[model samples]
Target: MKTIKGNFIFDKEENKEKIDEFKKFIEKNKDRKGPLMPILQEGQNVFGYLPEEILKLISSKLNIPLAEIYGVATFYSQFTFIPKGKTDIHICLGTACYVKGGADILEEFEKRLNIKKGETTEDRKFSISETRCLGDCGKAPVVEINGKQLAHFTKEDVKKVLEKYK
Candidate 1:
């Protein structure tokens, strides 16, 4: 229960509703066969991210050990323990993109946003991530801002591109 940055502490009044919903969801699925994964996924969908509290609830309600829940969550990249930002910036770092200065584009984004890869900005306005591939290597060095692809990106365009989000 140590405080981890970005994971919502479920004790907040605002999170009560979400916590209740998570409990209900777990209860509804408790009778199903091999329900842990689906319950975890639904909890993430409901809460936006799988914070510690939600996992604890799932584990307690399902009669599964906390370590087992943690193990399953960690095994899947689809489950993020931390909260995502308002805008998710995915910079491609695949072989094609990297060969074409994608790494430089990623660095520029980190510098401009003041956050390293996989970290969200303090204001929560943006999260910078290094994506394996954006599926558009033809336009190598592709950047996706909030799921909107920006192909053939350049460092000079960084300021202008970010300004649009602001």
Candidate 2:
């Protein structure tokens, strides 16, 4: 039906071989009753993220309830249903960091990126977020870029780090 973002769009001709492979895997594991995770993992790897249609297809193929499939996916934080940006910026909002201008840093990031928390830029390069703590409160006002942490920064420091993405 309607095309959905962060979801699967079927292409029979392009995916024929892969779909056949998945069918085999499902059939082989049909009797085992624990193939859901493996199937979803593989699906996410192939598709970058698990879409609703793909989950349904998986549930139907495995004879697992759709609710269980969805529940499992939603239960795990490791599993991402939405497509992720190339670079992730996590600004800590921990108490130490907060007083040290964490909020201001976040605000500056929003102003520069022109995207709010949980939103990916149109180019899909930057995904700015706020997190509770990065476990380095001593380095108050920390900003993590693509998993690397830089702490004890000023507003200018935030700007310079983000400008590299452009």
Q: Record all residue pairs in model 1 with backbone atoms less than 3 Å apart, i.e. clashing.
A: none
Worst 10 residues of 2 by lDDT: 1-10
Per-candidate RMSD, Å:
2.4, 3.7
Clashing pairs in 2: none
For candidate 1, write residues 3-39 as lDDT tens digits: 4545334444677777777788888889999999899
Scored by lDDT, the top model is: 1
Model 2 reaches what TM-score against the true structure? 0.71
Runs of candidate 2 exceeding 4 Å displacement: 6-47
Worst 10 residues of 1 by lDDT: 1-10
What RMSD does model 1 have?
2.4
Q: Once model 1 is optimally superposed onto the true structure by TM-score, how far is the C-alpha of residue 107 displaced, in angstroms? A: 1.5
Could you tell me the TM-score of candidate 1?
Answer: 0.88
RMSD of 2: 3.7
